[model samples]
Target: MASTILVTGGTGTLGRHVVPLLRGAGCSVRVLSRRERPDEDGVVYVTGDLRENAGVAAAVAGCATVLHLAGGPKGDDEATAHLARAAAEAQVKHLVYISVIGADRVPLAWLRSKLAAERAVADSGVPWTTLRAAQFHDLTLAMVEKMAKLPVVPSPGGLRLQPVDAREVAERLVELTLGAPAGLVPDLAGPRVYDLAELSRGYLRARGKRRPLMPVRIPGKAGRAYRAGANLTLEGATLGERTWEDFLSERVA
Candidate 1:
């Protein structure tokens, strides 16, 4: 593999964590972003938008591997396809993607896009790997904060979430990009699973806010899938290095 690695969304949460680790590992990292950035010590900041072919081509060209972390509910499919095509053209050895834990089973809009992106990477003919990780503690806390905006906090009934630390996921991605491509790795999840009410209450306690939780059953197939634990992996899967409470303690401290 070449020494230079291209990282999409290098300024994102996971990217911010992964880029430094990759730099410390002695890899010359290139980051693609819509906005221009000054070059770092070992990171080559290449401004390129993934929506267009030429931009993606510039980012992937001359890079040995790609760690794609830029995507959302909208335009994820298109961007993934474009980035994959560019990587294939550049003969990139590996393309490691960070996907949600239940992309294949969860019916969420963003997860659907991730599942499509997984296909794009696999079908691109470039050796690729995908890691399905649980939601980040930060993200879960953000969700709880949004829920708190409502008059009453309505927790999804029987929804158990395994919120993984973003830093742990970033470390795993860096390790994966350094190794040979291995299709799909076992999911990375938090040490413990917390039900919706419990998680919400934890957040409330941390923030010194008390809100009575109203457990409501989320109706439909997606809710059923969540209630059935489609988002959780089998036994012996959770990485268990960090916990949401730990993350909260750090953030609050």
Candidate 2:
């Protein structure tokens, strides 16, 4: 593998950890961001946007591997499609994309965008690998905080999640990026699954706050999908070692 790697979202939650690991593994890293950042040791910064072909081309050019991670529900599909075309032209050796578990099965708009991005990478004519991960522990905590703001904590009934650590996901992404493209790898999830109410209670326990949780059914197809556990993978999936409680412990410390 060549020593240079391009990570599209190096400033993101997972990318912050991934960039350092890549450098420690003896690879020079380049980060693409709209905002200018000072270049650090063993890392380079490139100012670019994924939406424009010119920006995408500059970032994709002269890289051994491209890590497509920066995206939102509105632009992920088109942005990834543009990246695929640029990467193919550059003949990038490996293109690794991060997606969410149940992206294909879930009926949410964000998941739908992710599924389209995955397909774009597959059809790009470039060597590629896509790994789907469960929700991050940080994301779970954020949701808990949001719900806690209500006078009465409202929890979605029958909603379950397996929130893995972002650091673990970053490590797995780096491992897959360095190796040969394996197409779609097994999904990664946390060690255990917890209901939304239980997770919120765990957060409350960590924060030393007491609140009553009111279970309610979420309306629409998205809600139905989540209630069916569409956002989780429990069959022969790779399990992350860090538990949500462990994450809270770290936060408290």
Candidate 3:
């Protein structure tokens, strides 16, 4: 029988690519989602929310491995714990997690939630591998769109990030799923880092929009964290192939 892998959040950005890769590797894939969808060839789609223990348990049944990627800005701790418990109950062999780089160092609420999820996975007693990566290129584009809508793009001076391609991250994740559960693997970063203001300007230039860049000093712990470079990978870890400029041009064109 082919090894079965359960992919949580299989309908998401990274999942879309990871699922296909796993199928290509001859692994039968079962995707957990919130909505029911028709299963594709060599893939099964199971509708369930991570918050529901019974649903998660059902999704993990008979699966040898799990790709736990369902996470958000809220209830991440509880959600991760629920999934961890489910994986344990189902006796899943390996649990692969996708986490953010510098999650431990960043003071943002979202990062804290991600760190809490990581802790839950560690304590789940299941063999796990966590891949911490920089912000996705899609995430950068979303940020730019949000900022473009605002009257002024608020750029916290000195904030830098190494935004990586989501597809590349997904490919690395697929490779990790086949390996042993190595805890807290090296950080995955992009080709280079750029200041927030400079990136914003790059976006504006790409889109042919002339908007005033407002470099402001945000007054909060989060702002301080950004200014302190909390979002960057300091160890110079695995660099992805895609550059931000290349991503920007492709996205803009």
| Top-scoring candidate (lDDT) | 2
Question: Where does candidate 1 stray beyond 4 Å?
Answer: 236-238
Candidate 1 clash pair list? none
In order of appearance, the predictions have TM-scores of 0.95, 0.97, 0.96
Shift of residue 103 alpha carbon in model 1, Å: 0.8
Greater-lDDT candidate between 2 and 3: 2
Over 1-253, each residue of candidate 2 has an lDDT whose tens digit, in order, gives: 5458999889988888999999989998999998888999869999888876557788777998999878775878988999999999999989999999999998978889999999999999999999999999988988998998887899889899999999999999999999999999999999999999999999889888899989899889988988888888979799999999999999843
Q: Worst 10-residue stretch by lDDT in candidate 2?
A: 51-60
Candidate 2, TM-score vs. the true structure?
0.97
In order, candidate lDDTs are 0.87, 0.90, 0.87
**TM-score sort, best first:** 2, 3, 1
Please name the candidate that would achieve the greatest TM-score relative to the true structure.
2
Candidate 3 steric clashes: 0
Off by over 4 Å in 3: none
Candidate 2 lDDT score relative to the true structure: 0.90
The segments of candidate 2 whose C-alpha lies over 4 angstroms from its true place after superposition are none
